[model samples]
Target chain A: MARFKFLVAALAAASLWAPGASATVLDNVKQRGVLNCGTDNTAPGFGYLNTKTGKIEGLDADFCRAMAAAVLGDASKVNFVIVTDKSRFNALQTGQADVVFAHTTVKPVRESAIGIDFLPINFYDGTGMMVKSASGVKSVAELDGATVCTTQGSGTEATLAAFVRARGFKTTKVLTFENLEKLFGALQSDRCNAMSTDKSALAAWRGNSGKPDDYTILPETLNKSPFAGFVIANDSRWRNLLRWATFALFQAEEWDINSANLADRMKDESAFVQKFLGAKDGFGKDFGVADDFVASMIKSVGNYGEIYDRNLGPKTPYFIDRAGTPNAMWTKGGAEYSPPWN
Target chain B: MTTLALRWVHRNLFAKPFDAALSLVIIPMLAWAVYAFAHWALVEAHWQVVGGSFKVLMTGIYPADQLWRAWFSVATLCAMFGAGLGLSVRPGRAASTVVALGVALTGVMVAVAIDVHSGMLAAGSAALGVAAWCGVHHLAADQRIVLSGLLAGVVAIFVVLSPPGFEVWGGLLLSVVLTIAVSILTLPFGILLALGRQSRITSLRVISTAYIETMRSVPLILVVYWIWIIVPLLAPDTSVPGLLRGMAGFALFFAAYVAEYVRSGLQAVPKGQIEAARSLAMSSWTLNVDIVLPQALRVVVPSLVGQILDIFNGATLVFIIGLTDFLRAGQMILADPQNSGRTYEIYVFLFAVYLAIGGAITYASRRLEAHLARGSR
Candidate 1:
């Protein structure tokens, strides 16, 4: 029995380590006719599985479809690879996924050391605190001398301690747990007076709680948390294609070209609008993708506002307000700016 | 009857003043706890959530059209399990009665939980299971043939399920697959490592010692993550599926601990057995294979069963590498904002399932241990 076992083990190990040829991610994706876009399958507003339709639907999911539409002229050509927070970077690095949109925050160490490049910021989130509404705490100032809970080793802990100190709360104690579930449990059990994390995450937790209206997110922002999609380093062709595809979503919103009215706008005589929609002398040829790539994308997954309204708008379950936030359009006095299409 | 009951109560609970006080306090508390749990589970809980998410919880994100594949896999497993159990051990009347009651209760629960189509499929599978059990009982003399047939069933399941790619495997299906694959692969690797550790050759001993120590030192997560990352770098063209990589890492890591257990078993085997074989002019291979291993493995059957249980529980960790196991599937169900505030209900359902499966495995191991002990005597 022992000798036979040894033979089997050796054979299995040998088969796993066999040598094979490699190819560039761009070539592989093009040949496969599918863009493997990794996204979070558990996040509520950003990316989530819709139980009714049995399809992934959210802001991040829309971006993946748009990328596929831009590159392959069919939004359905995308394979939505589910990635968690820990595996997102590794998935991109190994060419298992072509692009990752797992709500990754832009950090200098990730770009310099991990060998990944971030596109323009798609969503700007910030750290905030939430307290039970019954406590009559409307802002961080009211939480002096109270225990606040966040995940251990997360940047939120340090940011929370700094905020408490700056406010001159001598008795404020910051408690840390290993994960969000425990932190929420601590707050629920009255072990902590408040919980601090990214506002988007707080919203999701609050939405999932028994009484969403019972909790209130404090007004003051503790820290910045701008998120963006990323791809592997040193692949300029693939990188540019993903970057421009993201930019096209915002540009479409700026040009008033949405999914519902895209065909009508295509008939406009303005040279700039015509070029923007890839009617004539389009810039898609310069980028090495399809000439009418943006048009295909808009037709499949609407403009940025439509995507937001479908996933995080007031009508949706998440109900995230984008009216006065940086996610709003530039014309509406928010920070969503688009570069020149010409 | 009243006099007898009073005597029993007086002896067990109220023999003295202190005993009476303790019984008065503890009995009511236990009764209240049971009552509260029954209320929450039976009446207050929203079981509709469990009913609605049943498919996703069974096979996450698998194509709806391909659901028949999952049912087929389940049917195959049922047949194999029935046949194996029928051939392995004979139970007395009391044990057989208990098993029958458990099966009847499970059948009633299934009929209540699933739709008509699924109930029909389940009934058909149960018929197949009954036929397998009867057939195996008649052919119990050819144990080798039965074992080979069971092994072929496992391979057939893999062939039917592997075509959809590892990414689509999620929920309970992923957990069962990972546990089975790791359990099958670990035994052979473990035996080799144990022999290497016990070898007379200096180089083999040192290398095996080093491998086992290194694997035992690091966390399972790091080993799994390293394999997930390094495999692609080593063979870029042939992308190994993440699920397979995770299974390989688990098998490798677990084999080390299994090697230690098997080594203890090897040590337990009397040195007289080997000396007797040598006196009979038996070769080392035949002596070890035909004599030492059978005894050693028999002594360690209980430990191997425990290791398999550990593998099943550890399957939940695959979510870190983006593969959803049973636990992660529950979280995914909660990820839908509409299912908010149903955390307790979802968690209660998951707990019930894990408890049921774990309890069943433990019961079988206990029975096996008893049977083996009887045979040795």
Candidate 2:
């Protein structure tokens, strides 16, 4: 009886860890005529479900539409599969989602151990601090003896400690709260001198605090947390298709070809522009899509900068300025770059 | 009348010095708290958040064009509830008042978030429910036929709602559907496990004990998450729907609890009843079914009803697997930057709905206890 139990346990473990049969995701998606794009419905400006429209509206959601347009020739042919922080990777591993764009931070262990490939970074996020405007503290360098609070058990706790130690602030005390709400409350009540978290979140909390001018976000970034989308590993054919589809958005922005001007650029006399837009000859044949797949994506969701502006720009409530951030195009002295379309 | 009211208050409030002092301090504070809460709820709270996101709160991202399926499913559910309630004993005054409050709240919410078509459907569903209740109550319908009919209604509702795909079934609708599915599916499996544990056969008893013990010891989230991950790994070719997988996890975990409840009921059955059935030379199946089960289930009816509430609350944990339930839906609404400051309104609404449903269940359980106890007494 004991041995029987042992055998049962072993079988269960074996089945759970066993490798699934690989099928090319591109073929499945093309045949299905719908792209299953996984994303979070709770992350504002990334992939939130807009209650008024009953539609997911954000940067990540537009990318899904763009992918659908590229692959199926219709932007509305995509189904938005809502995934949480815990289940995003499993959604891809189980073939439930063709690709995921859930504001996931690119990490080394995730790629190495989780059997998924990380795509190009879409947004650059990092730890940032916020202080009350009345305190008159300008930056991290001025908080020599101040107390800093962060959400407990988050990576920000360690980031805060390392920064304080490196800056040689002997009297700086670090505090941790159970959540951001409590951490913010502590800051408001003057229980802590500063509150720190992701820069995007810092901006959001400040924007929604009813009196946005009462708090000032410090002008120092503690660490890099570049966000990227991902897909299942060992499928370069599907991976390459998604990689270039993403790059096309960046390249379009670089070439000043937004949705508003796409038509004019398509009719341009330059052979390179025509070839790049798939008007005469294109890279789409090699990528297993239509010759004008790039045009379809741009037409559906616009260029990368436009997507960023639409979701996280000054018009939106959670606006984080992209003027000097790494999210800007390379030509504007930022890191968003695409290889030449030779 | 004034003198009598003063005397009554004096007798209750000033029976002891400490009691008088406590009443003096507490009554004014309670009144103030109630007034402040009323002021916030009525005057200060932004209810537009709830009105604006009513459809998403009710059905999540269920396509606008396919809302009729959800409405039809809701109508069927209302009919089933009405029929079920009619088959049971009539509610006491307290239960009636609770039901009236729930209905009034629902009416107010619907009026606030009114769309012409949905408003018509809501009225139709309530009418259908009332019609069902009247039909069952006046005609003296057979319980067995009504139960079988209700079962068919569940299947019909699932058929109507599933074609739009399982992924879109979310929000409060998802919570209710998942709760009902898990509650119904757990029943037979739980009974079998209970009987197996009480069986004379050693291997069967051991297996049932091991399963029940193992399941009850683990947290519910682990079971749900592992089932979600393992189903696809075990059957890599065919994609199992997430809603179905979530339901399976809930049913499996709750079955053990149901088993324990049923086992307690089984033990409560008198030894003499079993002896009397056996002395008549009745087969084990006939004895257990016709004799023992009725008594056992009667003793356990209140507990089983309470378990339905447990399942409803536990249904919220399905968000880990990406199925947005009622609580998750509210959170999704708050995630919108427009609704960010309306957290209190959304949370209060969710709290009121949960409290109403939970109170109704508790009232039903109390009524069942009284109803079942009448003959025994």
Candidate 3:
């Protein structure tokens, strides 16, 4: 019995054996009837749950739902499983979720050591800090001798602690909460003077607090971990479909198309827009989907810019300015670029 | 009066300076725990946080409307509990006090878990019926208490379960319902498997032993995962929901463990007892039931209680296959931004809950072991 249990644990611990010889996650998901998509149901503007609708909303959730719509053709066809920072990889490798869009940052160890594969960067969020106006703490440097609250096992906590220590900021107390909500709550409740997290999340905390004016995200880009979607590695076919589906959302935005306007935009003189929308040619069929798959995804959700701004961009609650950040489109001199749909 | 109280403590805790020194260290830790619990339970913790979201505590992602099926289950269990104690085991004064403490704890839970929906009332009434029947049965044997109690329990569960298919069952209640239902469900199977293990027939022994060993060898999660994945594969026509698969997996896993324990008890029974009953010319059925089973069960009562505790703890593993219980509920609640900063608050609650339930199971097992020992003596 113990030997059998050891075998099971060894399989779990050695999760990086690559995918099985045949089949893709797409097949498993299709057979299962519902898309087992992972998401954070707390990170505002990324993947927070709406109390009223009880639905997970934000950029990452939108991508998960849109992928579900593209594949399953129903946005509601998803079983939105929640995973925390510490448990995301285990959830995916164990097959609890078919796709994880839980603000999962791409790293080599995760791909190699942890045994999972990364999709395109779904949400670009980097580490930043927040402090009250009264503290006169404008940059990371001013946080000397300060007690900061953040979550444990997160890259942000490590970076912050290192940055403070490197700067020789003595008396810097780092308190770790299991989630940012607690860390932010402790910040608001005066339990801790400053809270740190990804820039997107810091802005999210500010917006969702119902009193956004009191919080300020420091201008320092302390870390650059881009949140990417992922799945269990080895299913290249399904990986391709999901990867292309993502870039298509970005391609749609680049073509000045959206769920509301893609139908009319398909008739434009530019052959690229037409082919991309499947108006001139069926582009999506060979990927195990309909030719109008990108059209449907754009129709169900929207283009990349629409998704971002609606959730995290400047006009949204996170109020993140996309014009100057890496999150902006290539036309705007940013990394939010995708290849031609064909 | 206080000095005398101190003197009494000194005698028990400080017979020697070393003992007194141990008491000094232990007393402060216990005192701190008491102080912390008092402040949190009475002062700091948020009861107001529980609103219409009662299902969050009861069942993680368990569809809310079907909660009645789960509530009705409580009455069925209460009825069985009362019947079992009345028919065979007599709970001592300490046992009765502990049971009252459990009731008080439930009452406290009721006060907090007060968002009772429609079917909860019927479930509540069913419990009252069993309590009344037990009272009447204890008062007078002529009242037909046993039969009435069983009927009320069954009917209540039937009424509640019929509307909401068992799929919507959830929360700690789901775990309890599953533990009780699965333990009862596994009993006959475990017994049969145990008997098969002991049988002289070659094929039956091999098959039963293989079944027991295979199940005992794997973790409960693997069996549940296999059932979750394979049930659909083998029987495409049958679509068993996640919760049912979880229950079935639990039954399979627990049946193996229960069989081993039962087999141990069977092994321990004195050969003389069996021979004496056989010498009286009693049939195998009568000897098995009247003598062997009673003695074997008494020997294994503590072990059985311990098994129930194991089943309760193992129910949490069902989450890997996506059936949420209490711990999963904590994760789900922390998903909300309002409750996001409340991980410390929520996890603390979960630890306390498991500890409390586990402690109760341990207490009951100890009490039963003592009772069985005393009865034997």
Candidate 4:
């Protein structure tokens, strides 16, 4: 038995020393015929697991499928590698995952220190204040001497402090609660004049609070926390392909071409539309994907707006208004935009 | 009969004035709580959420077509469990009847609640278990055969399930597999550590003590997370599956505790037993394995069984490394916005399952302790 145990240990040790592959990530993904897309399972409307269908369904997960469609021409050729916030970057760095769409915030430090390059911002989250509509406090400026509440130990506390100092609010006191439930409770009980948190979380709290109309979220965002999918750093080949694939989603929305209208757009007589949709000419040569990779992606998951609506639209409980936020398309007055497809 | 019932109730619940008053105060409240729970469970709760995702709850994200592999693994496990039971002392007639009734109840529930195919597979597995028990119950109990059978069963389960990839293994299936693997693998590793700690060789004793103390001092989550991270770094080419790494972490951590339990058991064995074996010119290997281990193991069997529950509970921490064990699977289900309103229903279901499994483990440990004690008595 001792000899057996020693043999087992030796075998395990022997297996560890083999050299890693040197192929580019894109090439390896293509050869492997599947994409390992790291994402969270707990975050609702982002990378949640849909139990009824036994499939991962959310904006982040769909983005993974879109990447799979762009690369493998089959949306289902991707595996949802469940990752936590702590392990997400490690997963990408270790080659355990090819790309991660786990709603990670785009911070300069992360990009500078971590061996990962950020993709285009998919969702722009920021601290926002909420007040009871009955209070008639329309904006943060109106809360001159009012008490504000936020979850304790969160970044919002510091951000709120900065905002209060910057705005020169003389008597605006910030209160902290243990969690969002308690913070919202403090606001509801009038213990605080307003509640502050991420705009997305604020929207979710209001939507699920059973009295959404009674509360109003202020329009002013306290700080920027734009989220984006990312891949390992210095892999420009894979990085560019994923970057353009995400851009394709934005451009598809801009062109009003979704999964529903993609067929009709394919029949468009316009040379630019044809080329953009890969009907006449193609962009796949530079990207090293199929000529119709964008079309395939659209057909699989749809445009950015459609994907967003599918996960975070009014039909879902976590509805965050996309009309006025930076998450909206550039054709509107929001920050999401794509470069010229040509 | 009425007087007899009254006397029993009076003796048990109302022997003293204080006891009577306490019983009066508590009984109605307990009754009200039970009634309220029953009412909510029967009428208000949305059980459709649980019913609809039952497969996911049982085997998270395991491919639908490859479900037979999971079922095969389950059948293998059930057969192994039955064989183990058969190797033990046979239960009394009343106990057998109770077991039979429980099986029947489970069958009825499965038939009514599950799809026909799943129900059939479950029935087949149960049948296999009974057959295995009948095949071995009357024969002479052989520890060697049982151990070899368990090892074969473990190998068979992995052979059947690994084709679908280990990462996709989740839900209760993942929890059970991790517990079983950790429990079995920890035993020998722990015994070696215990023996090493007692070794006269100074280096072996020092190394064993350092490892055991270090593992016991740190948190299990840290070990699991680091192993998950470091294994890939150490073996950059070969990607070790996350489940295997998680299992390794669990085995490494629990082996320390097991070592402690076993070391105490080793101490409990009389020094005279070793001396007697040595006088008989027994080899060191035979002395330890035949004389010392059996006596030491009998003392520690109950504790070792209890450790199975510890391992099962600890398995839930695998979520940090992103493996969806049972509790994490429930969280995954709740993460869906559509099921957000059914939080209580999902949580209640998860609580009930954990309670049931934990209760069974405790009961089994008690039974084993009693069985082991029978010899001394």
Ranking by TM-score: 2, 1, 4, 3
Q: Over the stretch A79-114, how does candidate 2's per-residue lDDT look in tens digits?
A: 888899999988887778889999899999999877
lDDT for each residue of candidate 4 in B1-377, tens digit (9 for 90 to 100): 99999999999999999999999999999999999999999999978878777777888889988998988988998798777767664755876777677666666666666766676677778767766776677775577887799899998888888988998999999999899999999999999999999887999999999999999999999999878877876777687999999999999999999999999999999999988988999988998899899999989999999999999988899998989999888888877766655767888999999999899788778877888899768
lDDT of 3 by residue, B138-211 (tens): 76554255656555665566466645444444467667766766776688789889878987789999999999
User: What are the per-residue Cα lDDT tens digits for candidate 2 across B180-293?
Assistant: 888889999999999999999999999999999999999999999989988887787787999999999999999999999999999999999899988999998998899888
User: What lDDT is reached at residue A81 by model 1?
Assistant: 80
TM-scores of all candidate predictions against the true structure: 0.90, 0.93, 0.71, 0.89
* Chain A TM-score relative to the true structure, per candidate: 0.84, 0.90, 0.80, 0.89
Q: What 10-residue stretch in candidate 3 chain B is worst by lDDT?
A: B115-124
DockQ for all models:
0.43, 0.60, 0.18, 0.41
**iRMSD, all candidates:** 4.7, 2.3, 6.0, 4.0
Cα shift from native, residue B54, model 2 (Å): 1.2
* Candidate 1 local lDDT, B185-279, one digit each (tens): 89989988887898878999998899999999999989988888778766767878889999988998999988988888888899999889999
Query: What TM-score, to 2 decimal places, does chain A of model 2 have?
Result: 0.90
For candidate 1, write residues A80-100 as lDDT tens digits.
888998889878777788888
How is the predicted docking of candidate 2 categorized under the CAPRI scheme?
Answer: medium
Q: After superposition, how far is residue A95 of candidate 3 from its true place, in Å?
A: 7.6
How do the candidates rank by DockQ, highest first? 2, 1, 4, 3
Candidate 1 docking band: acceptable
As for DockQ, the candidate ahead, 1 or 3, is 1
| Pairs of colliding residues, candidate 2 | none
Candidate 2, A32: how far from true, in Å? Answer: 1.4
